[model samples]
Target: MSVITQPTDLLRQQDPQMADVLAGERQRQGSTLQLIAAENFTSGAVLAALGSALANKYAEGYPGARHHGGCEYADLAERMAVERATALFGAEHANVQPHSGSSAVLAAYAALLRPGDTVLAMGLPFGGHLTHGSPANFSGRWFDFVGYGVDAATGLIDYRQVQELAHAHRPKAIVCGSISYPRHPEYSAFREIADEVGAYLIADAAHPIGLVAGGAAPSPVPYADIVCATTHKVLRGPRGGMILCGSEFAERVDRAVFPFTQGGAQMHTIAAKAVAFGEAATPAFATYAHRVVANARTLAEALEERGFAITTGGTDTHLITADPAPLGLDGPTARGMLAAAGIVLDTCALPYGDGRGIRLGTAAVTTQGMGEAQMAEIAGLFAGALRGDAAKTRTDVAELTREFPPYGA
Candidate 1:
């Protein structure tokens, strides 16, 4: 990469107005109600680490060794992150290099399976993510993938079907976990199916890592051969990803992340990861995790009581997925309406529902110090907006947002 010796001069000369835009964005983050399931508010300390001096370094290898020079500080920062991550998740090995959850999954696939190998994953409309073998992504194009789905009656995974598919296809890996599925995944069932078929088990705990770490949710580390996650979501860290695996695949996973997928680890991101890991070790993080779940359940229940159909009946994690078709709303329309009303949710398709549902979470609001009371009010705003009186809903949300001011920078 070419060096920019006068980045400050360039910014000051060419994009002074852009600087003002950034400040306005910060003001929005502070003033708005953020219900996006995949987003969270990181600590000021974590943000500082992400913008620290460590970003200037170019360390091409793991701690203690590098392909480039000047890794003394990088070694310390990376080692801290590695150690904390292992302790937090009880994993045998951890790779903090992948830039996002998608990259982490790619690295795991690279380490465990060959291109064109058969893989079994959850279907997208049924609460699965695109990276989990959607046709538009590389995972689908390069691999022969068979999918399993939730039971139409129960809205939960049907393990018998998964078993039958595994026996028929003989996949090399079985991927569990999801982006919008509300109920907890039956990891043990997935493990049994993988074992029956002699396949590796990979758990994409991108949305539930914080719950697992906080002991509020089940740990996939004990059952999964590899666990991939994003630092951003429920982890409430900077926007990055990680891959943790059994000791046997340590070298292979590292090689896949470094030589195969990514060039060099972003030292600044690793530093931020260390900060997040440290934060996760604290009691406050555990409380935050518990509150996130509590708020989600409360919101889901309130929405259901208001006549909206909640997917999977309710939520056991940070997100709530509900179909808005009964109210003449599609996913995109529901999302736009909520954003306009300042309630801020994303649109997603339910596993078996006929229409799109909005996916909302309590992480950001919880970070802003809103409790269950605030969650109830937010749920009211959602109901009002869905009922087509978004003006009043927007005013209500703005008021609630004012009460729970943003975590000051």
Candidate 2:
């Protein structure tokens, strides 16, 4: 085996400019509160695996069945990822390839739906992802996509509307899950709707797979015909996607991922994913998952106390989407203001209209060992930033971040 050098050393030797960029990013992450719902600080062990020599290989097929030579180690890594994922999600089969969350969704679509097939999914502006049939994405261009939105008054998923749309569209597939939804998706209800319309249910658990595996949220594996997720997010894994399904659809999903979506899998990333899966299966991860939800609730309450309107009232998961209009700030302005204070988050459009909203998550902060008290402090800093005390809030944020260093220092 070839020896692997530290990223800083190797990059410094090859390109000093790129090395500076990496160092700057590392410092930024180490000093900031990462509240982005889709982001996390992967472990150092995962980073090592990601930067390993396994990246040099080109593994084109599943374990024990590869098209290329010299895949012994690659096969081991991929098999470990597949097994751990299957075990983690309690699925009959798991495909550990597919380069991204988008790729995974594409593969799932290809495996189940034909061209021009109708798919009923949540509207993009209503918290659904682009791959969930946004008009600009391939999912929308290739297939007929009907969208459902939240109830206008409550800002919650209108299941009655979903069923009505399902019955009207008679879609071939019903996609569930969202990028910004604060409450747990009614997966069983979606399954029922899909059954009523003779449609396959695709659960895009990309944002909450860790919560599912940690038992903080309900698992969709038992209800949906196919489930897709990105290994990052709350899972705290490398950036990659996975597909989980029953035995009947295993082969179809795998083929769609391989010949249909991508070529050789990234062995290094797969190896890192296996590491993350192992970490997630531990008992400690369960506590972390629950704490993430707890912290989110605390933060939402804090924000609400300061006069911010949390969409859906509050959060049952790691994410919270707050209407920042009451704060006299638009989504972009709120994001910029908070970012300047070293509090990182994203801006999203509200479920209805063109108004902007602020989306916050507790996964990364909880991972950094922050608890409810810290969440309250963070929420205070958020209010301070919006209330024109950004400098003081920045200092407070720095102090808090110092107490809970990213990557555990």
Candidate 3:
């Protein structure tokens, strides 16, 4: 099949203005390699579904239960999505309604926790998301969130410390998962701690859902009372979120999402999510997930070879954190220089203080079809750019990205 298929052709002929938008996007992707740890490119099929005719309709409730009429087709689509998601994650019920990962977290919290209840969560600066317990977020406003952090010296979560916090706080829920940590959390350990303290275990697997689904990483479905995740990250889906839980909590979860938060669901995005779920169920997604981890490790090794200090000594998943101090750069500077060179990535603080580190991942590059060999090339560009060779880095990134355009375009 040709790379420029019917969609590209139809847009070029019927809608030149919209065609220009896509062309510009294609040009950008062809000239830059993205390394942002939380970002990934969805398939063209997913995009097609997102922009499909389903967007024209309004569906106010779940299948066989709606506040409005003319929803038979919408009901079918929603049911397919719900069933596929539950099967994929091995959960008893799934809600594909939350707008984003954070929204899903809010729904779970609202369902399982009451305001002013004490909660235990990982510290935000230590790999936890803002929704977990950040003061400015609703999670913090509604609950007293006591946090645990990674050991300062080891850069890893201290399980004993978490257990101690749970015992001390007597939390209503113990949130487990991270946006930046490398090593896997002991979910069963967390469950044990939660049980001992009479707290519910909520696993925020937004970063590792794809890995878990592929069996390359462990699943928390069996132990966690509720699981929340973004469908876009490693799942390679449209930008949406999901809430998965066992039958025991299904009613409360649904009620929280419908009556407590949000109005009509975005049926178009749901359709796109359904397509993404189908794509993720394939054996190819397993291969893709495994390669993402492999690529991260390779990139980490390459950076360490050049004297950068990797967080936790290495990565066991799709992301890696490296101190830019050795390269004469800080997180902000490294991010700016890399973006100018068309290599997009984020600058993040380490588990402790304002530790200088640039967080990188393999999903975007792997989506662009670059394996370990190309990762080595991109890492070299980063090393050069950070070490006072910006000109060479820009030139090299443009060349390498042009050769391996994302989506295989």
TM-score of each: 0.95, 0.97, 0.95
Among all windows of 10 consecutive residues in model 2, the one with the lowest summed lDDT is 1-10
Task: List model 1 lDDT by residue over 1-409, tens digit each.
Answer: 0111222556657798885676567667766788899999888788789879999999998887699998999999999999999999999899998999999999999999999999999988787888888889999999998888989987888889999999999999999988988778889999999999999999999999888877778999999999999999778889999999989999999999998999988999999999999999889899989999999999888888877788879889998988877777788888887887777778887776666778888888888888888777877887788777978887787677777766542
Tell me the whole-model lDDT of each prediction, alpha carbons only: 0.86, 0.90, 0.86
lDDT tens digits by residue: candidate 3, 187-216: 999999999999999999999898887776
Q: Judged by lDDT against the true structure, how good is candidate 1?
A: 0.86
Q: Give the TM-score of candidate 2.
A: 0.97
Clashing pairs in 3: none
Model 2 clash pairs are none
Residue 288 in candidate 3 has what lDDT? 89
After the best TM-score superposition of candidate 1, give how far the Cα of residue 132 lies from its true spot, in angstroms. 1.4
